[model samples]
Target: MYNLKNKTMKNFMTIALLLVMVNTYAQQVDSIKTTKVETVTDTVNGEITSKKIKTITLKEQAVKTDPADKGKLNADRIFPPTKVKKTVMVDYDADPFYDEKTTLKYFELNNDNYVFRKSNDGFIMNVLNKDEEVLKANARQTKSGPYYVVNSNEFDGIGFFNKEKKFVLEFYNQKTDKLETIEFAEK
Candidate 1:
């Protein structure tokens, strides 16, 4: 019984030693092969031409970087400040929201002589060159479509668009201390 146990232990150690030797040999034999093929096509004067390129790499070597020189930027050596061109920033006012393709809806209030232009979020109102005000409002979606509700320190209103390209606003005016209904038709 003791002889059988000894024989099995020897067999296991021999198999483990053989596996370790095979793994060590595989690590020592380090080589890589890569093949790349590229094709280019060109057409000139209705004539077609094609070119093929093939590249093969037998082995690759890893680049060794110094641990002491880690995180050291070579900015001054690569791009000197004197050789770099100074960027000139022109003082120009450009409106990003004003697109050439966008059609602005302009409306005039008949009773108050106030003109309003429909913007992205709200209405931009001008009272006959006397005053220009921007009223920010949000649209509330309903079954009838989207309706804008404007609530500000000056006035509070609920406005909706009609089929006649008119915006009807029912609002309470704080300055005049009156409830007013105004219609703005697109012009």
Candidate 2:
């Protein structure tokens, strides 16, 4: 009877230890969830805008014991490989010329005082509402042909003549600080 009592106590102690280990493992796995939040804001023309983004990640906490390593946890098997992704966003006010999806050939300059004309001699600055011509500069000649360079002065850019003898003008926009290309086909 004494031997039987000792065996039963030993078995009870073993079951209790197994239960404790299982509970500890379950707790570790449950703690692997994480949450992250991000916010972005921008101010344009006296108006403020903001955006919030959230991310949730879960990692596996289970480790496999390697038989070859004397029952030690395998470092490579503990964590799974994850892939990273990247995103890009673009935001800007709508531009009329860009929204049209057509290449510009003409632009009114200085409150309609001058109309830019594209010609073989680069862009011609002409008086608006008049047939008078103001200034004409020939595009710089290259081995392939005349390739105009866009500059700040607007008139200091290149012009190309199509078969119809109309001008295509490329110049710099001072306000937007961008290069603009337009074609003026009207004779």
Candidate 3:
């Protein structure tokens, strides 16, 4: 009788431990179902300024198990749908006179207005009159894209096309000792 009682108690203890383990595992799965992730990006002047990722756990839901339908899992019924919000920011400032198609490297700037063209020989500075005629003073590429710099007694800047095909220009400001950027986007 003593041996039989000991065996019964051992069985009860083993069953209790297994029940605790199963409950713990169920809680872990429930936690995973309620987890949410969010992503955010900020862009300035066609460049990524910052990115952020965050994860959060939502309220727990009551899950039901059917002994008759064992091993058949319905994911939609087990976990409800969650909505995530994403945010992005873009900033652009473009120069009005730069043209990407012309084969010359020189650009004309007159009273805050200018025209840019590519040339094979050297730098070309032209002053445009009221009739839109070119008055050549100093300078003058291929149809293919190449990085180019425009520097003259009055204007100093660099122009290039980015991978996204956006025309970007950086102008040096001698008075403030800073570089001002201008970008032209196709879209």
Query: Which candidate has the highest lDDT of all?
Result: 1
- What would the per-residue lDDT of candidate 1 be over residues 86-186, giving only the tens digit for each residue? 11122112332312221233456654444444456655554544455454333343345477776545556887888976778789877788899877755
Candidates by lDDT, descending order: 1, 2, 3
Of 1 and 2, the candidate ahead on TM-score is 1
Q: Candidate 2 regions off by >4 Å?
A: 1-125, 128-132, 136-140, 148-152, 163-165
Better-scoring candidate (lDDT), 1 or 2: 1
Worst 10-residue lDDT window, candidate 1: 79-88
TM-scores of all models? 0.32, 0.27, 0.28
Clashes of 3: 11
Report the lDDT of model 1 for residue 142: 37
Candidate 3 lDDT over residue span 1-187, tens digit each:
9999999999999999999999877764333323233334677799875333333323333454545667777423444322221122222223332222222222223242233333454334444466473644332222344655656664467666689555566778888788887664422
Q: Which stretches of candidate 1 lie above 4 Å from their native place? A: 1-102, 111-115, 130-144, 173-179
Quote model 2's TM-score: 0.27
Question: Model 2: per-residue lDDT, tens digit, 1-187?
Answer: 9999999999999999999999877644323545555556888688986555444444443344344566555433434222221122222333322111111133343344444544453443555466555553344444467555534334556666678545566776778888886665432
